[model samples]
Target: MLQLREVNIDDKQTFDKYITKHNPQISELNFTNIFMWRNSYKFRFGEVGEMLCLISVPDNDEPFAFEPIGAYTKEAFIQAIDEISNYFKEKNWKLVFKRVEEDKLDYFKEYFKNGIDITDDRNNSDYLYLSEDLINLKGKKYHKKKNHLNSFTKNYEFEYVKLTDDLIDECIRINEEWCKKRSCEQHRNLYCERLANLEALTNFKKLKYEGALIKVNGKYEAFTVGELLNSDTAVIHIEKANDDIRGLYNAINQQFCENTWKNTVYINREQDLGIEGLRKAKLSYNPVKLVNKYTITCK
Candidate 1:
């Protein structure tokens, strides 16, 4: 039998255990975000013995529920969805599953059918397939990217290392400077709060064991952290670069893809969130394919 239970602060250990056992590399769904958003949201755990399904709902929202961050078999996924839909219906709520992954679209469509209204929000995530064989690239494409990388390497004597206590302070300093210049209140506030929460930051660092930090002239300029989605895939959770530099963004991006993800076959850069500049920047990379995310709203 399948049952849904609310996830509370006490369930942290269990949640982390589930993540560690099933998928250790995808750090985006770490306990930090779950705890950070816990008060503003509610988590429901669908369980059948050792298997589990997680669903989140924002405090102010009633019609929609965020996608489950954890893993589940297809059968368990459908069962959980059905049970959750019934629960929502009882409460007079129309459940909408947000950010449904492209690969699971068919499953959702087949199961939800006429009961749920499916909509493609037109947002897409770009993913790059890494190849250790540099010879696979076309002459023109290969030359262009190589030229850009070479230029950045020659211009900046930067170092990429694991984010440590000493270097994290530099990342905050650079990030603050960048935010101040742009007058980005939202990012600045969130960054400051995250920094102040030592435990959360520590947890993030722990989860991002393979994260990289880029320093130019011994000063932090950019940083990115991610986890492996699967044995062959790594997903970047956060990437921030010094906006003052000309090619720092491109350089770090290329470096991480080439150097950091050497063993992985694919890199999931996550979504663009419907931002024009973000969309354009992601599009310029010439992604191998776009991961289409959808939302299903019950009528």
Candidate 2:
């Protein structure tokens, strides 16, 4: 059986080697995400050769594993899958892989005897956009976004601040207020997200996060957190803005990319998780591309 350990900040270096190399471009592959959601999702890690394997137990779903990260080879995946399957069997759980890239399905098909059951997990597909599109918002398609940003700048006395130790507390307070307005305590997923946000903010430095804060009228009203997912891609993990503040969303979205992640070619804002409003909001920006993801179940 593969020896799995709880995810921790200390494991980041070791994990990043494999994660960065694999560059799955999936949000879950980011170590910060795995670490922040560790307790909430019961995330655990193990290693097979140079590959990294992970398993998570979601409260509302059966325990599932992630596609092994690192050197992409048939032998490594087979070994990791077999070892993980044995681990699940001992616990009497089904062996399932979540967040499996659709492009990798053919490889798995060759490994399985009768082929695996692959399902389109549209809700979990990541929306990828050109960093330039977000920073510039120049073309006709971005006319509305430009208006929103302009409206915000013209109406409010606001400043963009780089996230530092002294400013994290303000961001946390803003997050707490946002949670109250959204009634996160009454919702499981939102509640979990709040917790995860807190964990990330508290351990922001140790997790190596880069973020920005928007201060309106000398008060922190919005914040965004992200990190380099790979050599050319930066992933935005969290972006919170006061909805009452017209154009705050557009402001933070544009400012964060312009200031902090300008060098990265692509910005991955992550998934919508089947929420209609969220899907619409993400699509409104006109993503340059969508990262197709899948769910695989081994028979």
Write down the lDDT that model 1 would get: 0.61
Each candidate's TM vs. the true structure? 0.76, 0.97
Top TM-score prediction, candidate number = 2
The lDDT per prediction is 0.61, 0.89
Tens digit of per-residue lDDT, candidate 2, span 239-265: 998999999999999999999888899
TM-score between candidate 2 and the true structure: 0.97
Q: After superposing candidate 1, which stretches have Cα over 4 Å from the reference? A: 1-51, 59-63, 66-75, 124-126, 131-138, 142-145, 186-200
- Model 2 global lDDT (CA atoms, 0 to 1): 0.89
Off by over 4 Å in 2: none
lDDT tens per residue, model 1, 108-205: 76776676676876654444545442213346646665676677789989987776666666665665666666666557445443443333344554
